[model samples]
Target: MSFLDKMFASIGIGAAKVDTILANDRLVAGDEVNGRIVIQGGKIDQDVDDIYLKVMTSYEQEIDDKKVHKECVVGKFRLTERFTIKAKEKREVPFSFELPIDTPISYGKTRVWVETGLDIKNAIDPSDRDYIEVHPSPLMSKVFNAVTDLGFRLREVECEAAPFHARRRLPFVQEFEFVPTKGEFRGRLDELEIIFLETNRNYLELLIQVDRKARSIGGLLSEMLNLDETNLRLTITNDNAHNIKDMLYQVIKKYS
Candidate 1:
């Protein structure tokens, strides 16, 4: 290789480029993701040490009393071992992986993407990012429908820092917030916050926080101190999806 060509490749000029194309961008959590990595050789041959795919998303956390956004990887997959791409050559590698059950859904400010990168020794790595739409799983859909049917409107959805004890495999948890607009709990409760603690093909575990409205002076004082919120865990299986509305109603009613 010419000295100039080597210098250019080192800075990513005329270097191999990578692009990942998914079979379908719209997917549900716990589903399989199929895709292929396409690499186009540039002006010179290069040795690719490895190829990787990472499922990434971002969450907000309070740092020094200020909200900061940071990225996190949900999963990672290796596609290929050491390989060489000749000048002006093109290559495609197939890949498939199970989308994590706890992958954050594409809702509100949350976004999920797949990052493809090629590792080249002594050369700048070429990378590509493709965003995907992640929908709720079957059991999660049931719970969301139940809440909407009860006249609770979705207020906001966000991924936030999770306390150490409450965290699972991730450092943060996705939270779904709702407010009663015209239901029996409208005046009794201020809001309802739901967190999917654990999910699988068979069942889902949720952490529900019920915030009650202040009634008496003592109640107002407790609310002012952020002590009027009740936290509870609920587990629902496929068989219980049909009655999820009633199941959730009773729990909220008890606290409201």
Candidate 2:
């Protein structure tokens, strides 16, 4: 290759590029993701130091009272170490990943994607992004459905910075917001927020934030002081998942 050619490749103008093709874009949490990454070589052979695939999602963060959206990596997979692709060569790498139980589901404004990159020595890395939809886990679906069964409608689902009280492995936590459409608790409660902290084969640890509707001057004062919001930690097990409606009702009742 000529000097100019080498310069162009080094700058990634004519360098090897990576593209990730997921077998399916829609998946449920706790399910397996299968995909193939295609690497296309340019005018000259390219030495790849490594290849990395990252699973990430977007979340909102508050900075100086201003909300900004940001991407958070949920998982990462390394595909290769010290590989080379000859001139005009094409290579495909197959992969499988088990989506974690706490993977954020596609709800409201939340979005997730897989990013593949070719790590080239002294060269700009070429990358590709493929978006995917993640649905609720069986356990999550059960609890969320119970809310609807209790006359509550799903209002919004979003990921935000985790509060200190809520221990989380990830920097951000997914919260499902709901409003009672018709029920005894309808007028008394303003909103209900549910955050799943962690889950296992036998149990699910969750955090709940209840916001009550202010009915008097004292209540309004408490609301402005952040006292009207109550946070609770609840652990539900496979044996008692059916009682989610009752459990949530009791919590709201207390705050109402």
Candidate 3:
């Protein structure tokens, strides 16, 4: 049987049902997550003292040199309602709350899951989990686009398991990886990794790793570049692009 069915059976309530209806399935940071909770009573009448909603996200962890998995609670809300439902009765309760901006994006889309449940003492709780997608603002898109235009292909995007201690408000961090394009460092590097930290300031931290290609006589040489600044924009003009080619030729001339 389904999880809901099993929960209701444990409560001796025959078959309780719960459903959630969201006003808007798509939302963004600083937007309200409005929805209604629907609960259907089972074979007999029951009193629900309260209702609660829990937002959760599943993320990866590292332990013993191996990857571990865990789910974290992002937020919780309690409804101030005590109602009685008769047998074969259905009830709908409305709820509206603001979503935290730091909510992790899942499935390449900015969507998070929320689970709603009823608090009936000594009874199996009826719960429902809903997924809502959030869209980032134009500023966020600008930063992302700039990186992509720089020939930095996305490697992987994930939320860091640790909470951003610097900023107590944010609970997770998003990391993006990119592979450098063939340029002056064509055969001299492997990839670059970027991590976006949470802070009141609207600046992004960039970490670049230069992996050197193996040579016949020498050992591998790797370098890292860390950039922390604001209003950062990287552009490749025709003149500069050509100049880069000249610079590459000069470098080869000196090395070879």
Best by lDDT: 1
RMSD of each: 0.8, 1.5, 8.0
TM-score for candidate 3, please give it. 0.70
Flag regions of model 3 displaced more than 4 Å: 1-9, 12-15, 107-111, 163-171, 182-189, 199-256
Candidate 3 structure quality by residue, lDDT tens digits, 120-187: 66677788889877565434455456555545456677655554453344444555555656444445
Better of 1 and 3 by TM-score: 1
For candidate 1, the TM-score is 0.98
Q: List the residue pairs that clash in candidate 3.
A: none
Q: lDDT at 223 for candidate 1? A: 100
**lDDT (10s digit) by residue, model 1, range 45-91:** 99999999999999999999999999999999998889999989999
Among all windows of 10 consecutive residues in model 1, the one with the lowest summed lDDT is 182-191
lDDT of 2: 0.85
Ranking by lDDT: 1, 2, 3
Question: Candidate 2 has what TM-score?
Answer: 0.94
